[model samples]
Target: MKRILVPTDFSEHAEDALKAAAQIAKKNGAEIFLLHLLELPNQMNDAVTNGSSIPEVMLFIKKANEKLQKIKEQPHLQGITISTTVQFEKAFDGILSFNKKNKIDLIVMGSHGSSGIEEILIGSNTEKVVRLSDIPVLVIKKDLDTFNIKNIVFASDFSKEIKKPFLKMIEFAKIFDANLILVMICTPNSFKTTSMGEKTMKNFIADFEVNNYSMHIYNDSNIEKGILNFTNMVGADLIGLCTHGRTGLSHFFNGSISEDLVNHTIKPVITFKI
Candidate 1:
C-alpha cells in the first residue's frame, strides 16, 4: 500500500480510522492522504440554499486543513507524511473522483459523516463509495476510538470461485499480522450437515497459507445478529466481508451482511467485491 486515502469529517470514527491507517502506513512505508470532502449544500431552494458561498466553502476547507494539521501534530502521528485534500460536492462523489484521479491504493473513511436514517456509521455516503468505487474501502465505525486492531474476523461464505480481490484481503491481514477468523453462520432450521460446511471453509483457507487462522461455524437465525455477537465475542477489530453482489429478492431478504454488520458492530469493517 504505497498510497492510502482517508476521508474524514473530523469525527471520532474518522480519527480512529486515521490511527489504523497510520499504523498500516507506518508498517508498509506508505504516504497518507487525509481527505475532507464538503457536501456542498444545495442552495437552489429560496429558503435553504447556500450553494454559492465561495467564501464559506473556502472557510470550511481551511478549517478542515487546520483539523488535519492538529491530527498530524499529535505525538502519536510523528514521522508520518500526512497530506490533506478537500473538495466541494456530494461526499461520495468527491471521494470517488479523488480516488480515481489520484490513483488511491485504498480508501479509508468514517462510517457516518452526516446524520440520516443510514447514519449507522459514516452515513450513506460511505456505503455509496463502497458500492461505486473500484478500489477497496476500509470503513472505521463510529465509537471505536481506541483502534486496537489485534484481530480481524473475515465473514465469508468460502465460495468455490476464487477471485483477485481475495489477494487484497490476504495482504491486509498480512500487513497487520492480524489473526483471521473465517466464520460461517448457518440457519437453525436448515438441516445441512455441519461437516459439509466446515469442509467448504477449510478448503477456502487452504488456498492461502493460513496456518494462523481458524474457522467457526454457527447456527444463526439472524446473520446480522450473528456477526455482531461474533465480533464482540472475539474482540475483532475489523470485519472483513466478501460481497458477492446478490440482488433483488435475495438482496432484500439476506440484505448486505457487510452493511448490516457495519451498522450493528462497534468495530470497523473492511469490505471488497468478490
Candidate 2:
C-alpha cells in the first residue's frame, strides 16, 4: 500500500476518515492524498472558463485550496507525506479520477450511515465509489486513535460467485494480521439447515484452501441485520463484504445487501467487487 486517497467535504465525518487514514499511512509508510471535490452546477461548468461565473468559481476554488493547505500542515501529519488536491467535479467522479491518475492503493472515506427514504433520494458518494471502483474502499464512520484491525468479520453467502472477491478479502486481512471470522447469514427467506450450512462452509474453505478462519451461521430476518448482529457478537474491528453493483430499477427495488451494510453499519467496511 504505497498511496492512500482520502476524499473530504470538509465535514467532521471526513476529518474522522482522514485521521484514520493517517494511522494506516504511518503504519504502512504510505502517502495520503487529501482530496476535496467542489461540485459545480451544470451551467457553472462552462461559466468558469470564460463567462460571468468566473469570479465565483475562482473564489470557491481559492477557499477550497486554503482549506486543503491548512489540513496538509496539521501537526498530526508530521513524518507522513500528505498531498492535497482541490478539483471541480462530482464527489465520486473526482475520487475515481484521482485514484486512476495517482494509482491509489486504497481509498478511505467517511459516511454518516443514511438509510430508508433519505438513502433512496440522495444516494451516498461512498457507496457509489464502492460500487464502481475496482480498487478496495475503506468506509470509516468514527474516529480512531490508531487503526488496529485485530479482528475482521467477513459476511458472505460462501457461494462460488463470491470466491474471487473472498480471496482478495483474505489478502487485505493479511495486511493487519487480523483474524477472520467467516459468517453466512441465514434469513427466513433463504433458510438452510444447520448441517447444510456447515457443509457448505467446509467445502468453500477446502476448495479455496483458506486457513486461520472461523465460521458461523447467523439467523436473522434479513442478511443486513444478520451481518451486523454477528459482527457485534464477535466484537469485530472491521466488516468485509462483496458488492454486486446492481443498478437502475433492479437496484432501486431489490436494493443491494452490500450497499445496505455500507449505509447502516457504523463499523469500517472493506468491499471487494464480485
Candidate 3:
C-alpha cells in the first residue's frame, strides 16, 4: 500500500482506525491522510444556499483544522508522514471526492455497528464508502495495536464474480504472509452436496492457479453466520469478502453480507466491489 486514507469524525472508533493506520504506515512506509469532514449546521447550509456571508462556513472549517492539528501532535504519528485536510461536505461525499482526486491506495475506516433498518435509511459512513469505493476498504471495529494477520478467512461462493476481488485479497494476504483459507458457506435454503462443493472449489482455485491455500465447505443457517462461526472455529485474524454478490440489488437492499459482517464482526474486514 502506498497511501492510506482514514476518514475521522474525532470519535473513539475513528481514533482507533487512525491508530491502526499508523501501524500499517510504519510497516509499509506509506503516507497517511487524516481527513475530517466539516458538516455544516442547517442554518449555515441555508446561508450557503442563499449566497449569504461565507463567515459561518469558513469558521466551521477553521475549527475542523484546529481539531486535526491537535491530532497531528499525537506521539504515535511521530515517525510516519501525515497530512490533514478538512472538507466542507458530508463524510461519504468528502471521502469519495478525496479518494478520486488523490489516488488513495486503500481506505481504513471504523464502523460502530448499525441495524438493518437503520442502514436502509442512511447507511453508516464506513458502509457507504465500502459500497462506493473502487479500491479496497479495510473496516476496523476494535482498537488493534498490532495488525498481525495470521489466518485470513475468505468466504465466497467460488463464482466468477469472486475472481477479481480474490486477486486483490491474495495480494493483501501476502502482505501479512498469512494463510489464505477459502470457504464456501452452504445454507439450508441453498445446500450443496460435498462432492459438488469440492468440485466448484477445485475449479475456482484451478482457474487462478492458487496454491498453498486451504479450502473448505461450511454448513449453517446463513452465509453471515456460517462465515463468523468458521472464523471463530479457526481463529482467523481477518475476513475477506466481495461486495454485491449474485443477488445484487435484492441482496444488498438493507445491507450486503459484506456490510453486515462489517457491522457485526469485531474481526477486521477487507472488501472489494464485484
Candidate 4:
C-alpha cells in the first residue's frame, strides 16, 4: 500500500481508525491522508466568495485543521508521514474525491455500527463509501493497539466473477503472513452439499497457486451470520468480503452482504469491489 485515506469526524471511533491506519502505514512505509468533511446547510453553500470562506465556515475549517494536527502529533502517529485536508462537502463524496485525487491504495475508516430507526432513516457514511469505492476499504470498529492480522476469514461463493477480488484478498493476507480460512456459506435459500461445496472451492483455488490457506463450508441462516459464526469459531482477526456495489432497485431486492457484515461485525472488515 502506497497511500491510505482516513475520513474522520474526530470521534473516538475515528481515532481508532487512525491508530489502525498508522500501524499499517508503519508496516508498509505508506503515507497517511487525514480528511475531515465540513457539511454546510444548503443556504450556506454560497459562503465562499472569490477565494475567501465566510467567517463561520472558516472557523469550522480552522478547528478541523487544529484537530488534525493534534491527531498527527499523537504518539502512535509520530514517525508516519501524514497529510491533512478539510473539504466542504458530504463525508462520502469528500472521501471518494480525495482518494481519486491522491491515488490512495486503501481507505481505512472507523464506523460506529448503525441500527434500528437511525439506520433505516440515514445509513452511515462508511456504508456508502464501501458500496461505491473501487479501491479496497478496511473498516475498523474499535481501538487496536497492535493491529495484527494472524488469521483472515474470507467468505465467498467461489464463483467465476469473484476470482479478481479473491486474488486481491490473498495479496492482503500475504501482508500479514496470515493464514486464510476460505469459507462458503450455505444458507437454506442457496444450499450446497459438503462434497459439492468442497469441489467448488477446490476448483476455484486450483486456478491460483496459493498456500497457507484452508477451505471449509459453513451453514447458517444467512450469509452474514454464516460468515460471522465461522470467523468467531476460528478466531480470525479480519474478515474479507467482495461487494457487488448494488444500488437502486437491485440493492433493495438483493441486499448487500458485504455492507451488512461491515455494520454488524465488531471484527475488522476489508472489502474489495467486484
Question: What's model 4's lDDT at 1?
Answer: 77
**Model 4 local distance difference test score:** 0.80
Better of 1 and 3 by lDDT: 3
What is candidate 3's lDDT per residue for 111-197, written digit by digit as tens? 663333235214566657776787888877678878788899988888876788788888777667789899988887778999999
- Tens-place lDDT per residue, model 2, 1-274, is 7799999999987898898888888877889999989888777887865556577788898999999999888888889999998888888789999999999988988766444312421466765787788777887777777778989998877878778878878877777778899987887778888999999988988866555689998898888778888898899999987777654111211335644554566678787777
lDDT tens digits, residues 80-137, model 1?
Answer: 8888776666677888888888898888876552233156333367666666567678
In model 4, which regions exceed 4 Å deviation? 49-53, 113-122, 247-255, 258-264
Error of 1 at 265 (Å): 1.7
Ranking 3 against 4 by lDDT, winner: 4
What lDDT is reached at residue 60 by model 3? 77
Q: For model 3, which pairs clash? A: none
Candidate 4 worst ten-residue window by lDDT: 247-256
Query: Which candidate model has the greater lDDT, 1 or 2?
Result: 2
RMSD of 2: 3.4
CA lDDT of 54 in candidate 1? 62
Q: List, residue by residue over 1-274, the lDDT tens digit for candidate 4.
A: 7699988899988899998899888888889999989888766676563455678877887898998898888888988999999898888788888888899989998766434212311456776777788889998877788899989998888888888877878878877888999998888878889999999999999999788999999999887778888998999999887777765101211355634544456788888888
lDDT score for residue 257 of model 4: 60
Evaluated against the true structure, the overall lDDT of model 2 is 0.78
